[model samples]
Target: MSVAARIAGPDLHETSVAPRSRSRMLALVIALAFAAVGGQLVRLAWQNEDASTIRVSMMSSPANTLARPDIVDRNGRLLATDVQMPSLYADPLLIQDADEAAERLVRLFPQIDVRELRQSLADKSRRFVWVRRGLSPAMAQRVHNLGIPGLLFVDEIRRTYPAGRLGGHILGRVDIDNRGTGGIERYIDEIGASEAAVGARLSARAPVRLSLDLGVMHALDEELAGAMVRYEAAGAAGLVMDVLTGEVVASVSRPGVDPAVYEDALDPSRIDRIAAGTYELGSIMKLVTVAMALEMGRSLDSMVDTAEPLKAGRFTIEDLHPLGRPMSVSEVFIHSSNVGAGQLALSAGAATQKAFLQKLGLWSALKTEVSSGPAPQKPQQIGRIEQITLSFGHGLATTPLQFAAASAALMNGGTRVTPTFMALDGEAPVVRGERVVSARTSALLREVMRRNVTDPAGTGRRADVPGFEVGGKTGTAEMAAKGGYRKKSVLASFIGTFPSSEPRYVTLILLFEPKGQDVTGGEITAGRNAAPTTARIIERIAPLLGVPAKSL
Candidate 1:
């Protein structure tokens, strides 16, 4: 072959190999590009699924929180408010060593259970776990200094009671997530006065104005605390309410619960005495009997034979200080004669007596802004024996709040008064309740109540405060125990009305298991304990309540 032909053939063979190599390299590059695109799509889909799972878990674990408006007294003083606090959480999956994490956390917060925390952290499946909630600024700072990798903090709204233990029963308590559990706090939720919160959002609604006068409440609390110490009592409760408007001015129950410490509220001894507890309040029931008598057209001077002990089925009711002579209706109240009250109750038949009490809202359950007061326990059958026993408050049990409202009806010119914790808005329309008694009967009842305080022989004379026109009735009821009444453990109470001529407010003071002291002349009667307490309370709160002192 010629040399030129051989060279051209070699060059053509090299050209064909170069074109095939270029085609193969192009296809390989395209295939790699398609593979990269597919990998990116798969990674994105996995990430999205993971995010969706987290979102679903978050939604399912409901974070219960409430955005509540400020609770203020009638004077616009803040009682309860929401404050921002740091809440701690941890990413369990991110924790490298759960034992070390839990140990460090427990050192910072001794209250934390180390074992539970360690178990929670070891659960790598769990992404989140609550470490602590409602941490104070100082506490949160200490936790931050720990430098734990998985630990984190989020701002949360927390309930704070500025008044501490003052009016605790009225203000009530909230849960860890800030949802109200009881008292006025729960009422706020029930009435739609609060909103669900997301994050640290605050309520934009107007503050809830309560009928409570902060000044009055503080004074009442101070006085009741002093009384508890002075009388050596197990517990004490007191309340002041507007007779005409039925607005609770001040109320206190001791051993008061601190709203900040939620556990204190659950204690049985710390229960709200003014509304939550029922007691057979002894001679205080005489107020209802006397009112019933007056409603039946009996005059204050009407006489009833209280010389003999009242007999019931296997029971005998006798006065502590029997007059031995017949007592006039007014004298019976002044002397607190249980037999006379029984006679009066019998005069008004069982049906009429029950009907009268029901009319006064004392024979059934009562609901206020604070709570649905326990239903009054009455005899299943209002037989002759039951009627006689109920006349002097031995067989019937009612809350002081219910009885106070009923008494207010008798003093507020016979209008039915429904007690309220919310402040009444003057601009808002008021739906007045039905009248419970004749105005004439109410007038006579007021006169008798005043006489019970002013007369020298009256059991409530100690309750009379100078210039305040304080008029009240004393009650000393034996406390009921496991099966029967404990004679020595008496509940002393005073139901008082100030400026009896006008009767603007009613105050009730109670001392449970008060001991006889030198100041009380070794007497456990309400006249020695609760009556004086009422006088002190009235003198201090009347001025704050805008009740002017009158000339004697």
Candidate 2:
């Protein structure tokens, strides 16, 4: 490295040299380490922002805010972190000519309004006008060479998501001040993890480890993105959660937003569909309905009348394919019989159905570290139509995150689950939440859920992963338009629990506005799209989660 290059970071104002006595040795070792990896560092903080190139400018503001602690995945992979970057600011009084300065700066940063910059520079009264914040090393060097008077660079701390867009929604974002703005970043601030009072250096505080496994998150993202392409879907979302602890191991929504890109977070299309947005979720909700029936003294084999369509005032409740005969409750779930589910709901009465849903925590909003999930939109009054439609996952809307949590509870021996994004250490107290249903009910639901996948004619048979014992349900609901549901545009979804005999994880996958492509035999149903997508994810992620595959 050149003497002058070592003296500065990228190209910024030179400062009194920071001690290089031991840093040179550290830099040499890092270079050797990078060389071992073919010059591609997997960006684990110090490894990426090489000590050889970066020099923290000895500049401080009156209030030099904290260098936020590093964020890592469950397996100690870097996610979000603070790296020293030079932020450009200006002192209006020092600028020689406002017009010239603005014109010169605008050449480097076209995004900066030349008129506004000129006015700010001309104002002699104002001192510390921010020219720009969070400039890359090369970009900072280009701006520094501009030699515009009054332009100054400070060694400000900036938050960076090194994993790029992977786990972006959950990693959250920070402000120009490195303060948490949204997602887990905001959660850190709420919990007082960002103690900025310490000097502006890397936080000595322990890295905030999240429950997200980078490997599992990457698998989930790749599969969901691929599903969108293969099925010609408008959007897709998926997540994997530990049924026992409600720890979300992997959650993804596409097209995903990069936390580093400020404007990407603002785009409506790029919203985190798993947690931030709510939908009717279609028939996967029948899992709750089935669980409720089991809790209400009904056995899986109990017969439910399904010979004719059930009426709820103006709307008639009918199955996609009616059996035209009484059917066992187990068959009802496997076939995804809307008429059977409605009959069960009617038999339980609206009050019972409403209370059962409340017990499962499906009626209210579910709050996690990432978001305060929007409350499910349900009928103002629990009339007959509302009761029947809700049983079949209509007339109610909920965040996929919330629905996943409820599903986890039913599979996890009926305990109420509170989903968390934080990694739970082995020593961390694992207190089981309140029981939502009897263990017997949970066992029966798990059995039925498994049967739904294993049954030859089951709606969810396509989701089966050999040796993984995948048990799941499929839902294909018409997307609601302004007036009524659009039959052509459907939301395909599947919810699965793996190693069904003893589920360790619950997975939920949703595909919005999927088209009837030739691959699906020109059908936009969850059985054809979402179910198979779930199988692909479970196949890849089961090994990552350390779940051994049993001989089928």
TM-score, structure 1 vs. true: 0.87
Across 387-424, the per-residue lDDT of candidate 2 in tens digits comes to: 88999999899889889999999999989889999999
TM-scores for the candidates: 0.87, 0.87
Error at 350, model 1, angstroms = 1.0
- Report residue 409 deviation for candidate 2 (angstroms): 1.1
Give a tens-digit lDDT track for model 1, residues 1-552: 234544566575566566577678789999999999999999998799788977865763345588999999999999999998989999987889999989999998999999999999999999989999999999999988988888988888899999889889988888887788888999999999999876777789899999999899989898988998999999999989999889999999999999999689879999999999998988898999999999998999989998899888788888888879998999988999989999999999999999998999988999998897899888899988888878888888999999999999999889999999999986777566799999999899889889988899898999988998888899999999999999889999999998999989999999999999999999999999999999999999888888899976
Candidate 1 worst ten-residue window by lDDT? 1-10
- Model 2 score (lDDT): 0.89
Model 2 worst lDDT window (10 residues): 52-61
Segments of candidate 2 deviating more than 4 angstroms: 1-59, 197-199
Give the whole-model CA lDDT for all candidates, comma-separated: 0.90, 0.89
Best by the lDDT measure: 1
Give model 2's TM-score versus the native structure. 0.87
